[model samples]
Target: MAANAPFTPPLALASLSGEADADWARAGAAYAGAAFLGGIALDADSRAAARELVARDRSEFLPDEPITFIDRELAALGDVPIQPAFNVRSATVEPVAEAARVCRDRDTLLEINAHCRQDELCAVGCGETLLRDRERLATYVERAAETGVTVGAKVRAEVPGVDLPVLARDLEAAGAAFVHVDAMDSEPVIADVADATDLFVIANNGVRDTETVREYVEYGADAVSVGRPSDNPTVLERVRAAVDREFGLEATR
Candidate 1:
């Protein structure tokens, strides 16, 4: 499998799911960096799993309408040339492969969602539950890689007993192009994972400014990602400026 293209600005808009609609995608594309088009559950089974969790907790925002195909859900982004990636969740390889194919056809990146911690998603053996089954997670990555699209896996770093670097290595062995890590509060894990695998590392979590962005890059992240703060143009610009200044790269925005 071919390695995915590197993220342009060394900065990305982390996946935010339901809130990452067409407008959000447009907003992200307007910036001078990579944009991860939120997490989209691959099929009915995956959507149901998310819905069950959302029903129990009204705060969780899942798609109110059903999204049957990954491409169909992402179609609203249209033909924008920005570096766009799609985050997906599934309990089995079939859906992952299917979504990966869509990404391949659309010329985008497909990221496996192994970072979500929803109770219902975990109960159904999806999301962060996949972290517990490294072998299965590898299988999922392998299946997605077969599509010839860039395959990335987004994983949480704080899961108890789960070695983040080891998991990253497993993904590399399975042919993933990059590992998107929600490092939580552990900046060291970013360096560790980068050291453990050859795959590109995109660091997520607690990045509110240039200092944090520079900190992650210093920790060995090929790219640093921002989520909630990306909704604000001013914050996004500040963070983007930091990346530009520290990395000596120009912003596309």
Candidate 2:
């Protein structure tokens, strides 16, 4: 584990759209070093995008009073030792700042969402579009960092024309503490970003077993995040055991 990253065992439960709430975090608490709650819609544009997703029968968080919702959910996790983090969606900077303030009060991580590739979110400038708009994303990070909370960004890998290493470096310059990468079929890019920036890299995508865990570890990822199978204790336990063994090796060297 990276000494500066708060994720203890260096494993995270990646946020499932609308499913990764307080109870979900509590359930995975024993396995994950961090539980990312929500791909919550934080502003008008994101809320609109979320509603569009919901219209298509997809799970999307469209909470009324977004900041209060964050506070309430964090409070509900009462005494779970897992680090609480929110993966939030917004098309502008103010909501990111507001969400960061709530995270600061809770001592949780606030991750700006630039990884969601849903067309509705992209059309609204809330998801993968943010990854393409580097300056705007950096501004969001800068504002969130101002609140003195741990700030990070959830970014996608393999997006054409987007240099993730450069974006990671830009985010680091803007005061991000970590980068949660959704390595959509391009696992080696985790190494690229890890080599390019000091940001604690949490690699996501198809993480289920020791082989997967060891692969990310060998690729220079500081941690790995479980996405679809995060709810399965069998998988979490398997991955957690692997993390202890693999990351322990890193600690030794």
Candidate 3:
């Protein structure tokens, strides 16, 4: 990512609020300076619990200072966005909505993640299974936006009967501001988003170098997300350099 390139969203966090407290330890690295750094895999129950567990220093499973380090750079890095991994079930459950509320009040971008494929989730009809329930998904999208938060959805390349392009459109109609397309497993990238029509798209998966980033942009992605690989710590530096260099070019223009 070039420094001048518009800021990309922080799509993944090193540590989830509840999944693995150890993951939070993965956050403080050389690349912790800026961007909306965050982790994922927090369920509704866990978020509430995590809030209750907030240490006196405001760190829970993670440190406030390091979190602050990333938040501080949000302005410098552009759009300090954070996506809380969510899987919606009932309006009453409203976990996704709760997460969005936090993001908006905190000035973070709230994204609904619909790409999980865990056997447990699928068996219970969540994650990708939700994609099959377009109407419900639409309602979920609407609910998130109504909270005054910028809405986004992360989706996988293929889902049983759902059409990706149509899903994109459905999401937009439901009030999504952005759509995250997961191109995991080195899957062949497909270009078919008539449904989303004109929503901002961010392609994730198998991304590391400048060329891969440019490829996604060429495919009409507004930006790309870098994750997991950054666990090496050195990879975080790569993202910093990539984002700075690209955005620098945009600045020159």
Candidate 4:
């Protein structure tokens, strides 16, 4: 079992369209224990894919030197109490390794992105495509682990023929410190993955009101991340209050 991240209430602000930078993290800092700051495209193939998404008017971070950009973004947090985590997309393992170095230097968590279902990203082997290739995804996790940063993956649920529980175990074996699951419509699957491995599980999707937050908590999620409504104080406050009420101080690590 991996040691839990220092996510106070164990709640996070999920990356939004690659725009969950420092400002976004700060905006939700009051309620969240951590914030995933990107679904950044880190290598040439992923960068090209990100550009394609941008062409379609989707938001993406396409910096010239991605490592520098990553360092800058993490640096911008400037001692916020919340854990700073970067969610990245890469077709190859090298970029993930490089980002791990930056994350290590900044004391940030590094998340590999296997949750993006974007056709453009998947076409380049950068996102949901990894969900289908367990070995490759594990290899990426293994390489990132070599860098000694707190590394993990943001995975999507309900991918056909993919057993997320098995995959979660594989990632745990590969030295993953945590697994952030986007439990699409199969919310109960959160329990399956959590049961499959001791890795810290962060449940995502439809995390709005107290009911939704309570559901994930009951399902064995060590934490929950708010998606589209991350910036909505009404929703985050409700979710935060629910988290505190459910998990309480004992939940803090």
Query: Which model scores highest in lDDT?
Result: 2
What would the TM-score be for candidate 1 when compared with the true structure? 0.91
Report the alpha-carbon TM-score of model 4 versus the true structure. 0.96
Overall lDDT per candidate, in order of appearance: 0.79, 0.90, 0.52, 0.90
Which 10 consecutive positions of candidate 1 have the poorest summed lDDT?
58-67
* Per-prediction TM-score: 0.91, 0.96, 0.65, 0.96
State the lDDT of candidate 3 residue by residue for 1-253, as single tens digits.
1222223332233222233222322352334321223333245443343344453333333333323433333333333222322222222227567656655665655556566565444554455766787787777789889999777676788566878888888988888877767876533443465224677666677667666666665565656665556456566556545644543443531
Off by over 4 Å in 4: 1-3, 250-253
Give the C-alpha lDDT of model 3. Answer: 0.52
Rank all candidate structures by their TM-score, best first, as comma-separated numbers. Answer: 2, 4, 1, 3
Give Cα distance to truth, residue 150, candidate 4, Å: 0.5
- lDDT of prediction 1: 0.79
Q: Is candidate 1 or candidate 4 better by TM-score?
A: 4
- What is the per-residue lDDT of model 2 for residues 66-176, given as tens digits with 9 covering 90 to 100? 899899999998699899999999887888899999999999999999999999889989889998999999999999999999999999988899999999999999999
Candidate number that wins on TM-score, 1 or 3:
1
Model 1 lDDT tens row, 1-253 = 1134466777788878676655676786756466787677766667788777667653333554433444654676667646778888877679788878888887778889898897777877888999989999999999989889889899998899899889988999999989899999888899999888889998899887888988888888888888888788888888888878777775443
RMSD of each: 2.7, 2.1, 7.6, 1.8
Summarize candidate 4's per-residue lDDT along 126-221 as a digit string, tens digits: 889999999999999999899999889999988999999999999999999899999999999999998889999999999987798889989999
